[model samples]
Target: MNLASISTKQYVEQRDKGYWIAGTRISLDSVVYSFLNGESPEGIVQNFPLLSLEQVYGVITFYLANQELVDAYLKEDEAEFRRLQEACREKNPLLYQKLKAAQAQKNSAA
Candidate 1:
């Protein structure tokens, strides 16, 4: 199937609406987020081996099919990611700071 277009039916779920990302261990939000961030479908599949090519295509299709839904999912996921990042920072002060600083420096240079 073409990876460029997908549908909601392809956006499978498990446990609950938000329990699994597109019917795989990967969450719907995370997959969409990575794809928006320029991750290739194959890259996403590799990162999430639990996902079949169809699942990846499905999520990609879902996002393409439902812009509003995908956007909302991405927003919620951003907050969740920030929460985790902050928690990690608190848990590992030095490492967190080092990585943050490095990332910031890299961005600034760019």
Candidate 2:
């Protein structure tokens, strides 16, 4: 919110009305995850061609500033995705159990 405090000197206001890494093609969540996993900013930018150096840095800045909230959102999304998957499984437990058992058997055999 404070332009003076923003070090990036340039950023795009995101869909969340939050500023993110300046030149990235995807959300900062993906960038943050990549960065946390040891991906370089340039590597991320190169991997996502549409993203620019500025965007990558901006995303890093944003991620640093609001990491907790972003992490929470990611966690929430994961939980929701899992919940949906569980619902699908519940809808057909016999089939799901059979598939799971088969996968386990295959895994054990391998």
Off by over 4 Å in 1: 1-10, 14-19, 77-110
Candidate 1 lDDT, 27-68, residue by residue in tens = 776777789899999999898888877878877876788788
- lDDT value, residue 25 of candidate 1: 66
Q: Which ten residues in a row are the worst by lDDT in model 1?
A: 14-23
Query: For candidate 2, lDDT tens digit of each residue in 18-75?
Result: 3345543366567778889899989998887788777778778777887898888778
* Residue 90 lDDT, candidate 2, scale 0-100: 87
Candidate 2 — what's its lDDT? 0.76
Residue-pair clashes per prediction, in order, are: 4, 5
Local accuracy by lDDT, each model: 0.76, 0.76
List candidate 2 stretches off by more than 4 Å.
1-25, 92-110
